[model samples]
Target: MQRALAASILIGAVCSVLSCYLVLKGWSLMGDAISHAVLPGIVLAAVLGLPFAVGAFAAGLACALLIGYLKENSRVKEDTVMGIVFSGMFGLGLVLFTKVETDQHLLHVLFGDMLGITPRDLIEVAIIAGGTLLIVLAKRRDLLLYCFDPQHARAIGLPLGVIHYGLLVLLALTIVASLKAVGIILVVAMLVAPGAIAYLLTDRFERMLVIAACVAIGASFFGTLISFHIDGATGPCIVLLQAFVFVLAFLFAPRRGVFALKRSNSHSAG
Candidate 1:
C-alpha cells in the first residue's frame, strides 16, 4: 500500500506538471495518443526480454514524431493524425497481446496493479518523476511561452524544433515512468485532467501549476484511499476523482465556471 501510494504520488506529480503544458498548448490529443501507443512496446519488450521502459519510450516518441511529421507534411489536421496513429497502435497492441503469450496480466497492463507495486517499481518512479519534475519546472516559463506564443518564443532566439521535440521527449519519458502505476488508459486522464481543472479556476500560469499539483496530489492520495476501502482499481479511482474535481471546477470556479459565465452575461446586459 505504501509503495503503491508513493508510485502514484510520483506519477501524479510529474503528470500534473506536463498536463499544464498539454492544456496550454492544446496537446491533449497528443498525450492520449502517446499513452495508447506504448502498449505494443510493452508487449514487444516482454517478448524480447527487454526493459519495458526502453520499448515504451521508443514507441511513444516514434508515434509523437510521426504525428508531427504527418501534420506538417500533409493536409490532415493533427487531431485526425493522432486518432489514426493511436488507434492503429492500440489495435496492434491488442493483436500482439493475444499472440505473445506473456506471463504479464493483460488486465493489469490495461488498467494497473497499484497495490502490487514493489519497492523497485517505487524507486524507478521516484527517480524518473524526480528528474522529470526538475526539468519541467526548470523549463516551465520558456515552455509556457512556447505553448502560448511560438512566434514570440522564436523571436527571442528560442530553437523552435528543440523546444517542440524536447517537450515530446519529456512527455514520452514521463509516460514510460507512469505505465506501471496508471497504465496506458488512465495515464491519459492523469496527463489532462488536473491542468484542465486548474485552467478553469485560474488565469495565471504559475497559479495553474500550483493548483494542478494540488489537485493531482489530492486526487492520487484520496483515490488510493478510496480504492483500498472499496476494493476497486486504484488507477480508475484516481481518474474518477480527477474527473469529479474537473466537473466541480467546471461548475463552480469563480471566473470561468458555467454559473460565473451566466452571471457575467446577465450583469453585462443589465
Candidate 2:
C-alpha cells in the first residue's frame, strides 16, 4: 500500500506537469479520449500476455497521431474528429473486453486498485514519467511558444510537427503511467484538474506547472491515506480531493477567485 501510494504521488506529479500544457492548449478532451482509447490496447496486451503499458502506449500514440493528422488536413473540426475517434476506440475496446472473458480485467482498467499495483508497474511509470519530464524540461521554450502561438513558433523555425507529436507522446506516456493507479476513467481528471486550478491561481506557465504538481501530489498522498483508512477506492477519492481543491482555488485564489474579483470591483467603484 505504501508503494502504491508512492507511485500514485509520482504519477500525479508527472501528470500535473504535462497537464499544464494540455489545459493551456485546450487539449483536455484529448486527454480524456486517449485514456479511453487505450482500453483496446490493454485488452490486446492481456490476450497476448504482453506488457500492458507497451500495448497501451502503442495504441494511444496511434490514435493521437490519427487525431492530429485528421485535424490538420480534414474538413472535420478537431473536436468532432476527437469525438469520432474516442467513440470508435472505446467501442472497439468494449467489444474486445466482451470477447476476452477475463475476470474483472475490464473493471480493473476502468477503476484501478492502487493497493494492487505491482513493482513492475511502478518501474514502468517511473521510466515514462522521468523521460517525459526530461524531454519537457529540455524543450520547455519550444512548447511554451507552440502553446501560445503556433504560427510564431513556425516562423521562428521551430519544428511544429515534432513538438506537436512530442506533446501527444508525452500525454500517452502519462496516461499509460497513470493507468494502474487511476484507471482510464479518472486519469483525465488527474491530468486536467490540478492544472486547471493552477491556471486560476497563476498566469506564469512555469509557476502553473509547479503549483499543479504540488497540488496533484499533495492530493494523491492525502487521498490515498484517506482511502486506506476508509476502505474506499483510491483513484476516485484522489480525484474527488482534486475537485475539492479546484473548488477552493476557484473561491479563494488570488486575482481570479470570486472573493478577489468582488474586492477588486468594490475598489474600482470606490
Candidate 3:
C-alpha cells in the first residue's frame, strides 16, 4: 500500500505538471493517442525480453512522428491523423496480445494494479517522474510560449523543431511512467483533467501549475483510500474523481465556468 501510494504521488505530480502544457497546447488527444499506441510495443518487448519502457517509448515516438509528418504533408488535420494512427496501432496491439504468451503482468498494462506495485516498480516510477518533472520546470516558460504561439517562438529564435518534438518525447516518457499507476486508458484522464480544471479556475500559468498539482495529488491519495475501502479499481476511482472535479469546475468555477459565462452575458445584455 505504501509503495502504491508513493508511485501514485510521483505519477500524479508528473502527469499534472505536463498536463498544463497539454491543456494549453490543446494536445489532449495526442496524450490519448500515445497512451493507446504503446500497447504493441509492450507486447513486442515481452516477446523479446526487453524493458517495456523502451518499446513503449519507441512506439509512442513513432506514432507522434507519423502524425506530424502526415499533418504537415497532407491536407488532413492533426486530429484526424491522430485518430487513424492510434487506432491502427492499438488494433495491431490487440492482435499481438492474442499471439503473445505472457504472464499476468500484461493485464496490469491494460487496467493497472495500483495496490500491487512493488519496490522496484516504485524506483522506476521515481526516476521517470522525477526526470520529467525537472525538465518541465526548467523549460516551462519557453515551452509555454511554444505552446501558445509557435510562430512567435520561432520568430524569436527558439528552435521550433525541438519544442514541437521535445514535447512529444516528454509526453511519451510521462505515459511510460504512468502505465503502472493508471493504465493506458485512464492515464489520459490524469493527463488532461487536472490541467483542464485548473485552466478553468485560474488565469495565470503558475497558478494553473500549483492548482493542477494539488488536484491530482488530492485525487490520487483519496481515490486510493476510497478504492481500498470499497474494493474498487484504484485507477478508475482516481480518474472518476478527477472527472467529477472537472464537472464542478465546468459548472461553478468563478471566472470561466458555465454559470460565470452566463452571468457575464447577462451583464453585457444589461
- Best candidate, lDDT: 3
Root-mean-square deviation per candidate = 1.0, 1.4, 1.1
Error of 1 at 5 (Å): 1.3
Q: Estimate each model's TM-score.
A: 0.98, 0.96, 0.97
* Stretches of candidate 2 exceeding 4 Å from the true structure: 102-104
The CA lDDT of each predicted structure is 0.91, 0.90, 0.93
Clashing pairs for predicted structure model 2, backbone only: none
lDDT of 2 by residue, 24-85 (tens): 89999999999999999999988888888888998999899889889989899999999999
lDDT, candidate 3, 8-49, per-residue tens: 888889999999999999999999999999999999988888
* Deviation (Å) of 38 in candidate 1: 0.5
Worst 10 residues of 2 by lDDT: 99-108
State the displacement of the C-alpha of residue 114, model 1, in Å, after optimal TM-score superposition: 1.1
RMSD in Å for candidate 2, one decimal? Answer: 1.4
Q: Report residue 188 deviation for candidate 1 (angstroms).
A: 0.5
